[model samples]
Target: MAAIPTSNASLKDALLRPGFTPTSPAATRLSDPIADTPLVLTLDDVLPYDANPRTTQNPKYDEIKESIRQRGLDAPPPVTRRPGEEKYRIRNGGNTRLSILKELYQETGDDRYYRFHCLFRPWDAARGEIIVLTGHLAENDLKGDLKFIERAIAVEKARTLYEAEAGKAVSQRELASRLSADGYPVSQSHISKMLDTIQHLLPAIPGLLYSGLGVDRISKILALRKTASACWDKHYQGEGVEFEMLFQDVLSQFEGDAEEFFFDRFQDELVGQMKKPLALGYEDVLLEITQQQRELRRSMPIVDAPSLPAPPAAAPAPDTSLPDDTAPGDAPPQQPPELPEPPARLAQQTGSQVQLPVTPPAGDQMSDEERQARIDGHVVSPANISPRVVETKRKVAAALGETLPDFNSNALIAIPVQAGSLHPISDLWYIEHDIDTPEHLREHIAQLAFEITQSVNAPGEIIPVDGGIGFSYKQPADEVDITETAHHTLTLLQSLSGATAIALKMLGEQPAPAAMDALGEFQFAAGLGQILLGQPTARDQAPDDSGRLSDGALVKLFRIVRLARRLIDLEIQEYATNTSELNG
Candidate 1:
């Protein structure tokens, strides 16, 4: 409640005032009052805590106690009596100091500090009296109180102390314990609510109240805080005011000219509410709006249809204004010829209902590679009930320029269902291609076959694309040398990369038609090249041989095979290595 004094005076000068002076109890002698040793009080007296939020705990209490024990009590705690109680209570300073005395007493069992007293020193000169009220001391001081933010911080400090000392989740009781520990002069619930207010309510208000309001006031606001007090109550660009707008306006008058500074700082509470549109606990409001909209539609008035014009002008009055047709014969003008019932097998899986679009993703938003990835890696199980998958397939059919027959309800069952979300790289994904030549078509077909089998089948266990059915471990990818073909294709691609003249050398060795498979031919030529380089050294080499894949000619055939089955290109290898290095 105090500010800078109009008149400047040193603290010592102010201490000279009549009621602000120091005094001593005449019960004991001053010179050797302690009888040589200091006294330590016990819990039988008081506990420790911070009296006000403005003041912090004196961490050096132990040292100060030690100093006092070594010398003497320099200052006594200020105390005041509770208004209507015989026991004394501390008003300004906290009981933390008393608790320190108690600790000292329990440790050393000395009561020297309490035993000492002054003998008739001054008539009315007392530094600060230890007036006990309701059994506690009052420690009112001339120094001004703390700011609002300062108090909030102190409240948090007290809360931390309570939690630490109790070693548990703190409650109001813990607040009380902290008050005793930190020398505070407060009630249990008061301290508890003060701490909670800062955390939950203050943050929601933006910078609205940070202009140094009173801690007690802010604490009250936070404790009384409700979701209704924040931004959701804003007029939303004045488009429409919520019912709470008037209440907020009324409250703003109480906050005064906090907005006078930044204006926004004061209105920050409102602005934050607007910028961050929030309505605490979503379910309630959402349901309310839906209910209202339903009610509105129900309240709409019904209207009758206008009379139909006479059909005589166009042709003849349709049936001469007869009632609507009950059968085709009655509406003979509009009737069409009927057809025979559809066959049972033809009714299995096709329908108009299949046209719904599900998994709505923008076609243009995703890149071609991403879209293709979905087609390539995704899975569609028969069990899946993809509400709009039929529509997706129809679109795909259009894209491929394929004919689509009139759908029959039974035909819908034939389509695959949603097994899970599309990963876009699964083995069963649909195939897409721009077919040009027979060679190209053949290559795509071979690649797809190899990819599907490789993806689903391992050397041992295999999961069939069909929910069941696959080859055993001993079987070779449908009785063909799939591994050898794959390796051959890899090597052929490698040979193509080198000089064109070197490629001609391969042609001279074997004709395209003669090669069982171009891919296999490429692998053979590449393996032969490796043996000549001695790149894959055989375990034991013969110095000479006829060279029909003999010890001398073969030259570590397994190693050559691995090299020929190359998956990564030179450029790709470099890129991968660089990326790995960066990640590491």
Candidate 2:
């Protein structure tokens, strides 16, 4: 062909970023100089050579052949140096183009519209093959180095490629498998680089590699980003930190410190997550995440603000005319006006004679229907009320129909285990509450809590999740001032829920409990509240001898002898009482 005006250019013709042109000669120049276009081949000549012995029998070949049959090949495939020849190589380029063309032709039925490019090498070298293939690797794909992170990724990639080429058995499949196994997914280029590493990257930073400047522009860290990040471009490992932990520590610092966020954020965030795949070193990271999520979702209930005594369930917004009871009636010892106080709180409200629904948790904002359901209590109550409670319950039953609504708040109670088990000191439970409800739910919740725990009970209510009436044994430190949120907490303690009472009882023992002061805010703050929250397990008990208990420790001294005498006398009294009862 005559010296074409556009003699040299990128064969693939992929989209170029700003300041780049597809047909520019720079796009196709070879890195190493050795080339021969497989002895005068064209798109049509690609399939017949069958020279790529490795993939000649590849199943994809049939698909390629079919493509070529339907539409002319679009672009040229890549190539490489022959076994020992300085030229006349057929690594991959031209064939790849033909395959693409074949596929496109079959896909669109118009092969002429298809296009492709070639990485033709110098008649004597494979430099062109190297240069062009390097373009396949975009810089956005690798993890940062322990130090000089960017360079580290590039160097590692280069080393992997070199190793694969040195090993004749290496393949793209192998490279992909290796990366995936390492928790870093391998891709086409990733695999290819591992196999041949034909592509290369020039120093992206001006003096980063030499001047010891920062590896500012990180690239190609896609899958590896989550494992860890380097600061000052240096990755470090603490005494016990894992590959992921190192990155997470720095990431934690960057959360509030991040001015410009990055995609690698997700990896850092999940690393050392507190709950699942639990990592103790990163517990603080998990707590921070919880706080952040709370802020972001607007789900945290505010507890500090002063709120008014929420009026009792409004008496259906007062009917038009006053009832006969309010009007002049045959007076015989006039009764007092009904107050909307909780049967317990009736004395608290003064001068207000409003009719209030006996709806518990009336202070909380709830829909009319929900209030009715809660007051009605039973989702499905007995139709036959035995006439006793007809006057008081018939109206509610009629209004609620078959919808038997239980308390809204979920109760979680922990049943303490026996010694040598998970718990030994006490048979009581730990618990947590999810929804707001009245005190009436206490006994019921406690009973349910007992049944669910398998500690003791007769057919108790089963909670939704596996754990029973969930209590927050994981409370604040003993010194933490929990009184601020006591009100909300107190409302929870209405003596109605055993779960709430037990939770409070445990907290109350501490100086400042988990009690909220009126609103859900902490009335008194402390540095040590949460510390006391975590329960002590049986293992924490002071063992008699690293758990080697001996009778000598308990019964060898004079004090033990006195206790022994007392025990014998007690037994004698118990025997006398039994004997008298038997005689009677």
The TM-score obtained by model 2 is 0.22
Q: What's the alpha carbon RMSD for model 1?
A: 32.8
Which has the greatest lDDT? Answer: 1
Model 2 agreement with the true structure over 150-248: per-residue lDDT tens digits = 323443453355355456544555644544443344444333322221122122222322222222222222223322222212323234545344444
Tens-digit lDDT track for model 1 on 1-584? 88966555676677776684458655542242222233333344332322444343344556766877677655655333333333333344544455556667677777663343222111112211211211122132212233444445555655564455456777766555545554545555455455655655444442445554544345334322333343344323444545355435533544433344332243334433433234333433333332333343333322212222333354434443222112122443333245222111111112211122111122343333233223322123222335486566557667855433322221221112122221111111122222222333233333333333343232322222211111111233454434433333333323322323455667668977754464454557655454344344456854431112322112222222222222122235667889999999
Q: How much is the lDDT of residue 116 in candidate 1?
A: 31
Q: Report residue 36 deviation for candidate 1 (angstroms).
A: 11
- Model 2 is weakest, by summed lDDT over 10 consecutive residues, at 410-419
In candidate 1, where is summed lDDT lowest over 10 consecutive residues? 340-349
Residue 451 displacement (Å), model 2: 31
Runs in model 2 with CA error above 4 Å? 1-39, 42-67, 78-120, 123-132, 136-285, 288-584
